[model samples]
Target: VGDALKDRFDGASRVMSNSDHETSVQRNDAAPHRIPRKDRYRFQLRPHNPDHKSPGVKDLVYLEPSPGFCEKNPRLGIPGTHGRTCNDTSIGVDGCDLMCCGRGYRTENMLVVERCN
Candidate 1:
């Protein structure tokens, strides 16, 4: 079955290629010749950069206090007391509960801190 299918596919491809409008091969009107049959595969040609690229969305890779952990430690806040110095607090959320925090607090929502100068 596979061999027969492969033969038919090759024949179809040969017919299509010969009838292609843009081919550079000049059709010879000379004596008839039996063209040997050969099995081959065809693959689509893709441009380096596709014409239509999907738009990118906001990545959750940086979201903190990951949604769903606990309730009591719900409201999340920045860690610090006074405008003394930059605290070395690293917040992390645990699986199953929304208890996300480090050093001293947790928040109900994820926090993102950025400095503008």
Candidate 2:
């Protein structure tokens, strides 16, 4: 999905009309201004797959650049961790600190499954 979102910038698709903004700018006497150029949207992917030592956000959400991420071979879309839940007091990986990926994150109340014991 990250690739698809990026590709939308390189094509004339109506999926995102608000994306028609300058990707970069040039400098002129210390001032910068928009300059048209071939654009490429750099993206990274982190997947939550089974068999991996840590498959849940609680274990993988505390990384800055995610030292060991799979930019390729994504089993899930790149909406990425935006929709994943987090623990309020997560001192480790699964907190807002890492789950937001520095881009920050927003929250919403929703239904979740719990073990019925």
Candidate 3:
């Protein structure tokens, strides 16, 4: 990120380079990512044109779309929460109001029997 931003400014290359310092890549076990090293970061392209009737939702990777994740990927064309099931009592991102994109949710009871100690 620093390298990319620095590249935008004129003569910034003289201020810093690989020879001048050691750069560290942080490891994120919780949210691993493989970011491109330079200006190579570009929007993943679909075909030049997409067929509307196709089942593809345009994300480079398929995820059960929610506003929290989908809205962030505008160019990727993820279908944000139009027909997802949500858990109203969830404290995390799967909460009804968030995951359902405020369209609200329906409930159907299920029997969950667990062994007790």
Tens digits of lDDT, candidate 2, 1-117: 878755543532111122333333344877755444444332232333333343232222322332332133255443456667876568668987777667666777789999998
Q: Against the hidden reference, what TM-scores do the models get?
A: 0.15, 0.27, 0.30
Please, what is the whole-model Cα lDDT of each candidate in the order they appear?
0.33, 0.47, 0.50
**lDDT value, residue 67 of candidate 1:** 47
Please report the TM-score between candidate 1 and the true structure: 0.15
Top of the candidates by TM-score:
3
Model 1: lDDT to the true structure: 0.33
- Candidate 2 weakest lDDT stretch, 10 residues: 12-21
List, residue by residue over 3-42, the lDDT tens digit for candidate 1. Answer: 8765554533110112232243345679644343431222
Q: Would you give me the overall lDDT of model 3?
A: 0.50
Best candidate according to lDDT: 3
- Model 3 lDDT tens row, 6-36: 4453221111112211234566899976767
Query: What TM value does model 2 have?
Result: 0.27
Clashes of each: 11, 0, 0
**C-alpha RMSD (angstroms) for model 1:** 23.0
Which segments of model 2 are wrong by more than 4 Å?
1-79, 109-117
Which candidate do you rate higher for lDDT, 2 or 3? 3
